[model samples]
Target: MDITQDQTLDITSFFCPMTFVHTRLALDRMTSGEKLVLILNDGDARRNVAASAQALGHVIEADESLPGNRARLVIRK
Candidate 1:
């Protein structure tokens, strides 16, 4: 899919619920079909944030691992 992200959210400093919370807030502010480039830390935050966004009916366009235990999650809201 061609993912054109409209916004970016960096939640690398957060964990768990906060990670998803920030992502959700970013999504909530966007229109349908718009995309977000979410930069998150590895481990729990990356996993849970993607799952939670998907559970809320958003689309996970891409999930790429960056250097230093980080990840970039592209979400369509």
Candidate 2:
């Protein structure tokens, strides 16, 4: 199930370095305790996006499968 009603950042078609890079930049702009909802449609992003977020001192609190191989992730700073 998808989590709606949060700020969403869609990086579906973005590739590797860009995927992680954009996620980081977006997260950086968010305030502490605020949530960031990411919709990643690429396969490579599903493989490593969470790690990138964790490495940046952020916590990927939840991940739920969305339709069409897309994943919905929530991160808290």
| Candidate with best TM-score | 1
Worst 10 residues of 2 by lDDT: 1-10
Number of clashes recorded per candidate: 0, 0
For model 1, how does the per-residue alpha-carbon lDDT over 25-77 read when each residue is reduced to its tens digit? 88999999999998899888988988888999998989999999999999988
User: What TM-score would you give candidate 2 relative to the actual structure?
Assistant: 0.84
lDDT of 2 by residue, 1-77 (tens): 44432478899988888888888888788888878888897467866898888877888888878988899888887
User: Which ranges of candidate 2 are over 4 A from the true structure?
Assistant: 1-6
Off by over 4 Å in 1: 1-3
